[model samples]
Target: MEQIVQAECCGKTITISTGKIAKQASGAVMIKSGDTMVLVTAVAMKTAKEGQGFFPLTVNYQEKAYAGGRIPGSFFKREGRPSDNETLTCRLIDRPIRPLFPEGFLNDTQVMATVVSADKDNDPAILSMIGASAALMVSDCPFAGPIAGVKVGRVDGKFVANPTAEELEKSDLEIVIAASQEAILMVEGSAAEVSEDDLLEAIFFGHAAVQPILAAQLELAKKVGNPKRDIPAPVVNEALKARVAALAKEGMKQAVRIKTKVERHLAIDAIRDEAIAALVPEFEGSEKEVKGFIEDLEYDLVREHIIKDGERIDGRDTKTIRAIATEVGLLPRAHGSALFTRGETQSIVAATLGTSVDEQRIDSLYGDSRKKFMLHYNFPPYSVGETSFRLAPGRREIGHGMLAERALQQVLPKHDDFPYTIRIVSDITESNGSSSMATVCGGALSMMDAGIPIKAPVAGIAMGLIKEGDDFAILSDILGDEDHLGDMDFKVAGTAEGVTALQMDIKIGGVTREIMAAALAQAKDGRIHILGEMAKSIAAPRADLSAFAPRITTI
Candidate 1:
């Protein structure tokens, strides 16, 4: 069935049509906004792999040269590994839709969105997120989503939904919100010191604007939806579960309260091994099941303690930030280097100044695009005290680096003013929580140390939420444990003036605007405190670049 569903969103026509492309897939949709188009297709494996523990869904978003009327610029003339932009876009589409599936439905589902067309003004990522949702909604998979995504920009004082590039350039905000009619499910964007109240209004306004787009998706699914295949529910051994719970409850509580991250991890491992030693004989060859039960219990214990007892794993108040320290000009030979440490989390961020020759150039359908400012983030396993071998930078590193880049993008001097290419590399040597925010703080310091005349010194902080129906606590400078066990991770970055960047992701189905407002306020305070501590290191940019760095001047 070739069906096209259309809607008017923020003065632009959005068209989602199915049945014409990738017909063999479970579900497929082509979304168009102006000349920008993305073709998203969803596919589910016929059967789950034996002992598949987690949902094996993969979302890949790619940009083809043909989409933007360009050719792939490579020796082989072939597309290879995903670009950082594509990787970040994949995260954008994956995070919101990943949770809407049944917990036990491990159907190796895949959603792939390719930018088949690009209008330079419109971003394909927004369309990709929308297309991914629409494809999954109509797929023969148990996806409880018809989620709609929109880009919210505030220029001057008024909010604009899905604003143009020109508007975004002048806007103080660039927020992307994904919703499910009931509440906001996913949000990731950067702002320019926007207030908590204004950010809240923009969120609500984005929610309202997506209603029609959601309706259009529903209509499209109605016409060309597939018959969902039902995978049998995961069978549970309640008797075995009860026995493990009774045996490990007290021991687990003791393990979670350990002060040090490594000690606590070791204790949990010992407990898991002890539990397995006790249960494996009874349920022979079901060691995986036994281990899974204990892990679930671990999550329950941590989450319940936070929500019920108003307790954090680290024994800090809900709104209390951890002790912070900052240092700059650490590397004598480098252009710029800063060390930002917040409790167990730390970042060694270095900035380099370059000329026009050093600008990162990407040849795509969008034409010869160049960026003067680039940020790279690296997370080695040793940072988290893991001994496992590591691979190349994955989606997390790319996403984190991009977030930090956006956090400081507004404060950067214009190319004409600075006439230099700037690159910031943030290395996570130790991590507990919000290493990306640490990057933001360290990146700013490194830039100043490199003598980039940034408008202001920037800092960032992560705010968490532990909500239990009516009772909720907004946490500041959350630890890794809280992030894993809590309801929300709301990260805000900015200078003394206001918020320059923000990102929020929730485990629960949706969070109210009230919670969002509270998180923003709390994050702002935390950011300010972090900035104050950073001031002890360097108040402003140095008057001169390093002698090692090349001098950049307008010719």
Candidate 2:
């Protein structure tokens, strides 16, 4: 039987339909808004792969050429690998739903969203996100979702929910917000240095606007949704857990206090190994559980230290930022260069200038458009003291680069004012956490070093969250370890005047508006502090372009 539901959102109607196609899959839904349509399907393995320690969830968003009434541009006359936009859309869909699955359910799951039709006025990405959520909700995938995605833009002064493409071009703020019925789950967007309060308002506005869509999804699910699969509780050996805790408790307490990341990790690993060795003989066939308990102990200890003592792994207070060091014009031969180091994270950014011919030509469903500025982020293995294949830049690098690019794009001179094609390359020389934020700071300085007349200098910082029941703590300028162990990784970038870009992802179900507001306020302070430190190296754009830079003549 076909099940359909529709709701009015932002002056437009969104329709979701299921049970008409892809019926063999665990769940499938087709969502439409305006002329744009996206079909999303969810599937999961009946059982998890043996001994799989981590959940393997894949999300793929593909755009078919036929959907846009166009032929493939490639020589083969067919669609190729995932495009940058597709990869980013995949990420956006994945972020909110990844944390919704039960912890013990490690079954291999996949969510695929394919654009079946595209309209020039409406964006299919938002529809895809909504479809993914609806599909998961109807599936027997054990997913805790019924979330919705909305794109909020400010036209003139009012917040416009689900703005059209033409409206977005004129809007000063463009943010995509995904939320559940109660709280916002994911937010990623760029703005024109919009103030903090205005940004917060836009977020809640978007969140409120999606409530109708969420209602429609629930209605549809109630009619046709499959019974969710049962997830077995993790088997716990109380005796073994108690024994391992007793053996490693003291060592873990001492290990977590060490300031150096490498040293602390080594100490903890030593304790874990020692506990496993001593207990494995007695608790045979329980090595995995023993290791799990030790890890849990460490996780608990770290959170306790942070919440009760208000201290982080680096001994910084919740609101304090790490030491910052910056240098510009360090590479004499490059067009422009800057090295930005914050705590253990570092980025070496170089800027290059070119003519109109160098501008990137991007072809997409919305048609071809030329980008006057480009940013590429590279993360080599040696940056983290590791060794791996030097393949092409992966999706994470691309995503980070685009984020930093968005952070700086708002401040760049208009194409009419500065017609030269600009490209900034950020190479992460070292990383602990917030490397993307470091890229943002370094990219700004490098552009200034190249004599680009930017509107203002931009800086970025990453904030973390640790929530346990009624208590929660937000950490500013979080380290890599904190990002892994904490519940949220929220990054904000902007000029001292306001915010330019924001990206947030969380492991928990979601956070309240109050928490989001607090995080943004803390991020603003950290961003300002980082900016002040950055100004010490180079206060503004240079008086002239680099001597080696090519001079462009506007026709």
Candidate 3:
């Protein structure tokens, strides 16, 4: 028997169905919104790969031009490589689900989410995750899923779930969160210097709204779910583990105690090298086993410190933000600019106002799209105090920039209200903690410095967690060292009234609501403090934009 359910998120009705299409796959579902529809299919190989240790799960998100009643623009007249936006959507779909799969299931699995229709106003990323989860729940694949995703925006200090693209433009905070029934799985967003408390509240708002979506998937699963497949678990050698632990115990402790990111990483590398060299003589045939032992030992040391002492490697309190400093109009030539520093991280953000022609044109399978607000993040070798040959922004840079862009999106004026293309560039001059959040803070100041009539100023802060067994410590405005040794990275951005953007990534297992709640509460205090410091530099936006910036009059 097939099941279909529909619910409203933001202003759109999301309909999900399973057991009616692609029945041959382990699990499959069709999701629809307005005239736009997407088909998500999940398939897992019966047998695990010989050497593949990680869960071989792949997520593909494709947007067909025909979905929007448009044809391809290229001479070939067909889709080519995935666009940057599509790649990002795929990442979004993958991150939340990848962590939720049951441990020890190493089967080669694939989750494909294809958009057959698009309304332009409603993004397909969140919908795709819903469909993917539904498909997985009903499939024979062994997945610990039933996750749902939603986009939260802040408008006039109120939180809106699944906000429309139009509403987001006017909001000061834009956050996307994916959650399971009990805990949040992933978060990604940008903010306009909202309070930490508001950000936490918004996350709860999103999580609560997503509960219905998860219920819908479960309902469908119970109706047509296939029997889950059985797979054998990987084994660890007790003898080899004991030897490796004895050799690496002392070195791993020292590695976790190092405060600076560079120093800690260097210490870890040296320890691993020494361990490998020592093992080459004792265990000539078990080099791989020896290497794995060293890694696990290092992780154990870091996790134990957090769980036992409630202390971070850099020695910070759970609710403390790093040292922060703000400087506005740092560059004379730029229309508006601000250099924001948090702990060791620093971002020089500049705002440029352009005419309509200056707007960015995005070409994708959907069609040609123009964006009035743009945020670009650049990471140079100097930021990390290292040297690299790569010249252009890599995937990480693009992804970070997009995250910050979404955070501040909620505060941007409506197109009709302020008709100018606003571009924000965040040049990472130094990085030790959260550069993207710094970008959000600097971007807000830069926009105001340029005299853009933003609804409010937005700020962002990165939160970290060190967990071992049941013991854990949540750190606010974390430094790079804490991030590296931490198990969870929970970032929240927003204003005094509500949250705008949030993103969380967990390395071990998922967290509980209690932990998430505590983290949010601490984050609120840090966010408010950061905002107070920013106000000292510039309280509100200037009345007029810089003379050098282009002026646009809406017709």
- For this target, which candidate reaches the highest lDDT against the unseen true structure? 2
RMSD of each: 1.7, 1.0, 4.1
- Pick by TM-score: which candidate is best? 2
Candidate 2 lDDT by residue in tens digits, 260-304: 877888898899889989999998888899889988998999999
Tell me model 2's lDDT, rounded to 2 decimals.
Answer: 0.92
Q: Which is superior by lDDT, 1 or 2?
A: 2
Candidate 3 per-residue lDDT over residues 467-526, each given as its tens digit: 667667788887776676677887777666656677788765567778887887777777
In the range 1-555, model 1's lDDT, one tens digit per residue, is: 689989898888999998888999988889998899999999998888997888998999899988877778888887877877788889999888877888789868889999888997778998998899899878888888888889999888999999988998888888999999899998889887777788889999999999998998888878874667776778999988998999898999999988688899899999899989998999888799889988888888987887777777877767778889999999998899999999999999999988889989876667778988999999999999777566578889888989999999989997888898888999999999999999999999999999999999889898888877798888999889889878888888888888888888888888998888888888888888888899999989999989999985567
| Alpha-carbon local distance difference test for all models | 0.88, 0.92, 0.81
Once superposed on the true structure, which residue ranges of model 2 sit more than 4 Å away at CA? none
Q: Model 1, 533: alpha-carbon shift in Å?
A: 1.2
The better candidate by TM-score, 2 or 3, is 2
- TM-scores for all candidates: the values are 0.96, 0.99, 0.83
Work out how many backbone clashes candidate 2 has.
0
| Candidate 1: C-alpha RMSD after superposition | 1.7
